[model samples]
Target: MNNNSNLFLCKATRNTYEHRRSSLLCQVCGDRNARNCFGSVSCAPCKMFFRRNLDFDLVINKCIYDGNCEMHENSRHACRYCRFKKCLTVGMKKELTRPPRLNQKKRIGKQITPPLIRRLDLLNSNRSKLSFDQWSILSNVTHVYDQISPLPKILNSLSQSSFPPKKRLRIDGATLADMLGLIYRSIYSFLERIPDFTMMSIHDRNLLIERNLHNVGSTSGLLILRDGDLYSNYAFCRANLNTYGSDNFEGVSKLLNRLDMDRVAVKLFVVVLAFSTCFDVVRPSNMTNNIQLSKSTNRLHFNTINMFHIQNKYIDMLFIYMVYRYGYIEASLRFAALLFTALQLCVHTMEAANIQEHGDMLDTIIADTTRKLNVEDDPVV
Candidate 1:
């Protein structure tokens, strides 16, 4: 047969295989075929669909049922919006996305600043070239974040909320919602206090805070999990699930199982997250026809160039720190593992936000907090 006929037959064969495999049912659809995509179990077609369309900000179909469409293997394609929501609902982790090409720098060559160029030089320089100020800044950022939102306090809260291993666990949805807000607020407040962050425009500052809040929360959540609370799976601090009417025990358990609990590596990873520029506003995809690179977007992009260098510099410092603490091979492995964790955290945070019943309410809280901060010139505490 010709190429088109052969391709049709191949697809038909795969569909038959999918129908025969009951054990591989997709979570997004009831298809008897599934493949692991991101962090969730999904069928190959669903996985490919999600891979191509994960960014919600991009223009897409509005669910006719208003995001309440029924999904089954045959009907899953009926509503793209509801289907994507289901993808997140079933815990498909976005961080599981294959790393994008490292050619973003090439797209923004004209936007690169002189300061950023110098920082890149410093980043490429030998470990021996590191100066005292670099260490001081890195140390200070870590210290201040810890001091502002003490991990011990979060761990202590988890311990307080949790019951004995054998006891039945009850999670208050309201409390979970409140805790999520608290964590986001703490992290946003911390981000604002990053040295020279205040120098940026208010719009850009808020944009950055909103964009990176999930990552910051994920880092905080992982840190809390790294403590002894993983066994309990009751995250009252970062990603709280309400066990009142539903079961999240298995999901939370799986999440904790996925975390890499290296304290030093995680600390450096948190610094990396603080400087993440992976937001739709910052890095709109080439496939995102709906998103326009307006003048404001370009301006924000330029502003973030400095921020990117700052993050890159810290990342370099992390590489050096890891190399110093562990041998080269181990450090490389740890860094890779940490990067995966960071990616997982990004996906986890998004899923967590959707799973929580109070997700939109929490966004409202952040919005109000942003307005308050913007209106009042009080220093971020």
Candidate 2:
């Protein structure tokens, strides 16, 4: 394929998997092509088709009810709007845009400002490189969104909620959704730093995310205890965990079990390990201190120093959010600070992975991705 065509494929694939947990299936046709997307797993033809539509921002489609378009399966090639909408719903953020304003470096000026206020400014905003995108999206949408989607209301309520002034480790209450959000955000940030992997084709990248989500979400045997009331107590973790692992995935017939094909955690871990392995960053086979994962009731406990480093940073964001949600407004600012620190580490971790180890074909990528985004500097056509 031509360089531009290759670039288009990579950008489409990247956008498709953005912000999605691996377990979330493909939006277009629900094909579980999280990884190893070639041959029966996913044909090159289909991938090319998807990219072509994305490259041109042609979301609407009119299916003939025949197998011709072959848009995976049951894909509503009939409605560009619905197809694109579904794509966004599944994880693609249609950030295909124009030139972004140069971020003014505030610290560039020596204006004497109180350190606490400056720090608080960073905290209120998610310390994410993707912050620009977040800000743009949040600013564009009003408090109300498409009536069929509840995401707008939820996000608005969250933004309206106040952050506690103090910091502390919380355990009184926590919700799974909060946990999922923190974890998802952290991982995405981490992955973003890896410049090497940043250039991967969409199918390969999505596979890593999809499989890892399955692994983490499907870990069985661990009990997730929840909030209690006068009558009895509810175990949100247990319930949610059970729900995540309920899908029957047994009898592996391929290198990847068809049933449990795309476990997100497993996929994510594999990619990280692969990236590490590719660059020879961390070697389990060579290291004396490295420990292999253990399986109990077929689930890794996910206990590792790195996990502790990552989890400790934001688990409290979860704890605090839960506490406040259940009526504890006077919570602490500990998690806020931790998440801030974690956000920095998250970026470093991704850079450490550097998906670019795959190749140096990165300069061309920004332009294509920008064009898919439809910005001025980078023209896709």
Candidate 3:
């Protein structure tokens, strides 16, 4: 062969090699720029998608098609079943996927020492009277509560609002839904972070949420108002009035004004309310009619003994902490007052839920939350 022909053929071979190297495609979705993930060549999105849905066998079985739908970059998200099937077909290894929560804990551990660890040092110095377990519960619950509380955000928003702080701001249905949704989401997120709560059976978790989330949320709302100095803010009171009506709104404001605003005590009390089997507080006989307005119809088949055990831990912690903070006699009076306030909050929440617009909004939020929790609780293979 001539010299020029030899050079031309070499150039063609080099060009082909570069093209092949640059065109790496995801094995599962045929997307370019792929890299090894879970033992297979995949794009970032497919990697995360596989990791999230790894244990959801039911999702894979419920394919809309014959379970062989074509999966490419454009069509991958259209059918999760086929996408997941293709991931497996292409040699993706479930064993290579890590538990996300474990990874999250590792990251958190590296970033900052947990509050429980700090409290351990205090216990060693004999400065703390609570047992190690009680301290652990208190630390975990308070940390999670701080992380999930919407008070700061609400205060910032209120500060920046066009209306004056003292002006009575009108709240429409959409505004009410958004406010309620935010509070409910915060409560659910708080519960999800508590290891004991999340460890419960999915049935029990959903049951607890349906029966008691709003009651807990009502107390949460009161705390936000007390802490944010919104109880007397005409705008806030007016908003509550629009949603809960005159009597209930006034009662909520009064309850907030009466709270002593003990941060730790209130946080523990919120956790206590969360695990309570039922809110059995004194109210007028006429209030019994409102039971029909509640959205939850499913009777509790939860492990009553186990739940009571968990709840008792928090109740004990609260009592001990209150005693530590305020003497026994005062703590007893304060505890009784807290229970009465909770009853009032429960009554007010029930009245709010009875409103047609509020009821519909709450029903939607509950349905969506339950669906998401079900997805999270799907069994791992």
lDDT of each: 0.61, 0.31, 0.73
TM-score of each: 0.53, 0.19, 0.59
Q: Roughly what TM-score does model 2 have, to 2 decimal places?
A: 0.19
Tens-digit lDDT string for candidate 3 (267-349): 88989999987862322222344555433333435699999999998887898788777756577889998998898777777
Better of 1 and 3 by lDDT: 3
- Shift in Å, residue 10, candidate 3: 99
Decreasing TM-score order of the candidates = 3, 1, 2
Per-residue alpha-carbon lDDT of model 2 for 1-381, expressed as tens digits? Answer: 699999999998888766453544444565654432322122333344444445434333222122132233443333233444445444543343222342244444445543545545544343232235433433222111112222233222222223331111111223334433333333333444444345554433433343232222222111111001000111322433333332211111111111221122222222233232122222221124344534221122222343444433333333433343322322234334332332333333234224332112221322233333224224457
Q: Residue 158 of model 1: what lDDT?
A: 41
Off by over 4 Å in 1: 1-130, 150-169, 228-260, 279-302, 376-381
Ranking by lDDT: 3, 1, 2
What are the clashing pairs of model 3?
none
Q: Pick the candidate with the highest lDDT.
A: 3
Instruction: Give per-residue lDDT, candidate 1, residue 187.
Output: 73
TM-score of 1: 0.53
